[model samples]
Target: MRVDVEYLEYLWPMRHYLITCGDFKGTANIIAVSFCMPVSKEPPMVACAIGKSAYSCGLIEQNGEFVVNVPPKELKRQIYYCGFHSGRFVNKFQESGLTAQTARSVKAPIIQECTAFLECQVTQAIDTGDKRLFIGTVLEAYADEDVHKGERIIEYAAGDFPRQVYGGRFA
Candidate 1:
């Protein structure tokens, strides 16, 4: 019985991702997100909604680039830390101890501990009430061969495979 609530997550157990924003020389920030999804294939696009006032949001708006990082379950603690803390107060990388490394086609760095990453340059920005959704074309992507057994990251998001393998809230 779905009861009314002030705020509720429609997809509570959705796949979570780490978004790295801004250039190294500027204000770089990392935040955990669960609203990310693939939008297209021909031009290769993905979109994620970020809070309008978030540090990462401003960085992505100014820099027009970000990295979508896919972390293994081992980094769940760090992910929780990122989701709770603000990058405006603390350097998430330093505080969370998540290593940031250069990405191939974006100024934003990728998390070294993550199993995969997508380097993107924003092509569209849509205002959605309190949050802004940024759509980016996936410029470059990388996956750990040892972890994925050589499976391309894009393949996992292709059809019914993701639904079959992913989705479980931490209860």
Candidate 2:
């Protein structure tokens, strides 16, 4: 039997990534995002959706850059923490204990705990009702050599990783 799922549930089980915004010598934030995907290849581009009111959205708008950090299953708890808390009030980097290191292209920092990262400069921002779609041109991308060898790398993050199943989302 096929039961109806929520509109977004149809896209459930998407890989979650930690999106860091802001730059060195200033404020920054970590937000967990699952609505992320590759949208181009010529120059390499990615798209991620953020709530219009999210703190990350504002930062991206102000800075025009972001870093997408791929976390492993080991970071499930930190992922949940960043997803549920608002960066406006909480220092997710400090509270979640995720390190923010400099990115090669973007001013935004990448999460040190993550195994891979993509630095992108926002090329476009489109308003889509309650969510804003940010399309970014990849400026830099890297993967841990060990993880790149395909050794114990966990698969894309599961939807039930304490997300809605636990009761909250990034604000």
Candidate 3:
């Protein structure tokens, strides 16, 4: 199959929320964008591409702590709102009507609305073209109690990506 380079570039839009704990204040802010979990379990890490001009990227670099809040498919509108706005200009939690709490290990805040949360400590940061690759190690993780025993957890994807329901194992 011949893939058109221009069309392929427009094929997918990645969507995710990057929450950080600020050093000066106790507030937690978020940036919504498309991110990837490049590695599965090797050292338990994930990567997020943040544009150089984004406000959240600066916070992540300055603090070296953040949380990846994976919201369920139901929060599609909230996700879109975060992805499109700047945290510097407005309080995302306030605008999105989301509540936040401090993370156990990292200074970053976690979105209580998410079905799952990943607390991360920045391990490395490298500039990749127009965006910076913010890589972090997962220090802690948790899932919502209500959805704990479900056969699958539904999550939304960016761009033309379809909603995904992933199964989980309980301990």
In the predicted model 1, the residue pairs found to clash are none
When sorted by TM-score, best at the front, the candidate numbers are: 2, 1, 3
Rate residue 10 of model 1 by lDDT: 40
TM-score of each: 0.83, 0.89, 0.80
- Among all windows of 10 consecutive residues in model 2, the one with the lowest summed lDDT is 162-171
Clashes of each: 0, 0, 2
lDDT (CA) per prediction: 0.81, 0.85, 0.72
How high is the lDDT of residue 89 in model 1?
A: 94
Superposition TM-score, candidate 2 onto the true structure? 0.89
Q: Which ten residues in a row have the lowest lDDT in candidate 1?
A: 156-165
Model 2 bad stretches (over 4 Å): 1-4, 161-171
Worst 10 residues of 3 by lDDT: 162-171
Off by over 4 Å in 1: 5-10, 150-171
Q: What is the TM-score (0 to 1) of candidate 3?
A: 0.80
Scored by lDDT, the top model is 2
Q: Count backbone clashes in candidate 2.
A: 0
lDDT of 1 by residue, 72-115 (tens): 76677787788888899999999999998888888888889888
Alpha-carbon RMSD of each model: 6.2, 3.4, 8.0
